[model samples]
Target: MRELTTDGLLDAVRAWVVIESPTNDAEGVNRVADHAGTLLRGIGASIERMPGRDGYGDILVGRVAGEVNGPGLLLLGHMDTVHQRGVFGYRVEGDRAYGPGIYDMKGGNAMAVAALQHLHATGRRPRLPISVMMIPDEEVGSPSSRAAIEAEALRHRAALVFEPSGEGGKFTVGRHGIARWHLRTEGRPAHAGAYHAEGRSAVREMAHHILALESLTDHPRNFYVNIGIINGGTHENMVPAECSAICYALVPTAAEEAELRAAIHALPQHDPDVRTAVTAGLGRPPFAKTPAIQALYNYAAMLAAEAGLPSAGERVAGGGSDGNFTGALGVPTLDGLGVIGGGPHTREEYIELACLVPRTRMLARLFETLGPGVAGL
Candidate 1:
């Protein structure tokens, strides 16, 4: 395989970051996907772009056939960012590259491309198959790509998610599930001054539900509940007839997820006259560490040590990723094997150039070692 130099890595990342693929922008994401498909095709990978559903851009799956037809490995990542166009643009400053999606995933995606180049150029074919799946909507909870991810994951023996590593360069061993609940209440509207007591204020009723939701947070168990967004009340002089709130809940395990779901469905009505409707949408199951996952971690940690990179410790991230879907399927999944940086989904996102070569080398090494029966552990 050809070596991935620092300059080459930086150029690839720059090409991707400048695309500005925000999750909600379908065409913007397609730009990046198309570019990535070109790169993969140039290296002899068969590219398949599946049309996206629910207003999302197409998902790209590039396959580089291996010598054997055995279970292959999956390099999973997302092509979308949370930032809007012009929120942040790409620029390299000394040893750091700053941009909207650089730290979150563009860097990681570039690294995967570089590693694949190395694997292909060596002329030493992989033992098992290898495929790279880049979805277009992970920032918005992979709503359109969940089925595709799960189906691809089932075909692979193991998966490596390219989410940005945790602070201190830790690999993700676990991640909490995300549950977004929408609560709406409808009540009679009345003029505040003229008939204050006649209206059952929907906003007031929503407040009670919000408090109840917040009370579900169990810090010790790592289950968190937050009522992040709320909209209600037409005017100050009128008792609001309609109110809606969006609550985000994080669960650390499947049991906790079930418990939280039951509680949310059983939420009581705060006002007798007000009608309440609760709907749960866009959730990812928690990614818990299984024996296979821990074993994979041990193998990867050894590779990092051999490559002279920092020891990658296990971590449990609070945020969710596409890894959650694979892990929930009982697949051996390892996450956070991407760029080393901070401030994801923020303006200060950047990646340290010093980690570029080492991480890429480690990834190449990982793919080489895991193929066939090379490391029969």
Candidate 2:
């Protein structure tokens, strides 16, 4: 495979960052898939575009076979960002690229592409085949791409997710289990001025439920809950008849997940006069560390030292990613093999420019060493 100079990698990242592919924008995401497909095709990799679900863009999978093959290594990432088109401008200042999706993922995606290109140009035959799965809709919990991720993961011997690294360039070893719920409370509406005593306030009932749900937070145990969004009451003078809220829960263990779900479902009726409904939303099972995961971590750390990088550390991130799906499916998975950066899902999002080359080199080396029987751990 040909080598990619630092300048070439930076230019590729800039091109991807300016595309503006938000999760719900199919046309926008497809634009990105087209760009990525072109890059992969340049390296003679086989590409497949799977039709997306109704609201998402298509999924992209690229395959490059090794001289010797069986189950291969899987490189995983998502192409969707949370920012809407034109909300954030893409520009470079000093060593950072400021934009909507730069740090969150586009940078990592570019790194993966560059690495694959380098491998192909150098004519390096991997110990096993390599498959890159760049799916759409990860910022929305990967609702439509979960099946594809799991399917590819089951075929591969291991997975490396290109999520951003944790603080100080630590790789993510575990991620919290996530679940969401939508709640509604209904009550009788009455004129405040004429019949205040006769009205049962749904807002008041919902307030009680919110407090009860927030009380479930137990940080010491890695169990937490948040009443992220809430709306209640219509006008100043009318006793409101309806209230609604969106809640999210995160837990570190399966036992904690079950406990949190039970607590939410068993929430007592704050007011018998008011009716309450709770509906569960989509969920992602936690990605916890396992023996094979640790082995992969060890191998990567060894390669990092050989590559002249600092001793790589491991982290347990609070957010969820596509890695959660593969890890929970019992695949040996490692995450955060991307450019080191911070401030995801915010206006300040950016990746450290200096880390681009080293991280990509490290990833390529890991891909070479960790494939199938190479590590033998």
Candidate 3:
């Protein structure tokens, strides 16, 4: 088997870490997608660049011909990060490469690119064709890209998501069910000094709803509710008429997700004069562990051992990814196939620079063999 060294892998990926592509920056994200497209094209892969929609970067879809015909492998990734550009500056200290999206994704995408290069160097392709899809909205629950992601996944026999390697390089076999809602409250505006008695405060009403949402969190059941973004009230002396917030809910099971959804819709009115409503923004259904997923994971462990990488274990992650979309669709999906790293979604996010090559080797082997080797997938 050919080897892609850690140093070599870092060199292949460093250009990406330096390009800060925040989710909201369509142009920035497309630059990353463009770089990926350029790399895929160099390997003789046929490519498609889809225009960005709903204020996001374009999507890159590329394909490498295979040795035989099958549903083909889906190499899924994204270029969006939660951090605004410049919030993180790329730097390598010892074995850690610090950057905005390095650990969360771009590193993983680069590793996949190397795995493809490895295949080319070995003079071999997998039993099925390989398709690469990189989107620009995953960090924000795939609001604009979910449909495309799901459609692309349906065309594949299996999907490998390059989000980030779990701690100790564990494979992410499942993810929590997650959702977000936009909450708004409207009330009559009145002068605080004069008509305060006649006006109901929208901020006061929203406060009640926020507290109610927070109260829905049941730690024992692994369920949580949070209002992360809040806005309301234009002035202090006047009774403000509008209030808004973004609410997020996380749960491990479909039943718990249902309970949380119902609770949000059932919030009682704290003031009859105030009007309130909640609307869906972005979400993922629970990607539950199943027999097929377990089988796929087990075979991956075998592949890892054969590739001389660390022993692999299966885990259920709290966060959601495009993997959540594919896995929920009942496709054989394995996530966290990216570089080993820590502190995602923060300025401190960094990748363990040394784990890149080994992980890429394992991924390359999987790409070369999974379609023909894994049974009942």
Best by lDDT: 1
Top-down TM-score ranking: 1, 2, 3
Candidate 3, residues 51-143, lDDT tens digits: the string is 998888898899988887878989899988898976759889997998888888889999998899888877877667999999898888787
**Model 1 clashing-pair count:** 1
Better of 1 and 3 by TM-score: 1
Residue 194, model 2: Cα distance from true site in angstroms: 1.2
- CA lDDT, every prediction? 0.88, 0.86, 0.86
Model 3 clashing residue pairs (backbone): none
lDDT of 2 by residue, 18-50 (tens): 999999999989998999899989888899999
Residue-level lDDT tens digits of model 1 in 1-377? 28678887898889999999999899999999999999899779899899988899999999887777878998899999999999768888898989989998999999988887888788655556789899999998888889989999998898889998887678998888988889999999999998999988999998988888899899999989899999999999999999999989899988878887788788798788999998888899988888888988888889888877888899988899999999989888999999998878789899999888888888887876686654342
TM-score of each: 0.97, 0.96, 0.95
Q: Which stretches of candidate 3 lie over 4 Å from their true place?
A: 1-3, 373-375
2 versus 3: better lDDT goes to? 3
lDDT of 3: 0.86
Span of ten consecutive residues with least summed lDDT in model 1: 368-377
In candidate 1, position 80 carries an lDDT of: 95
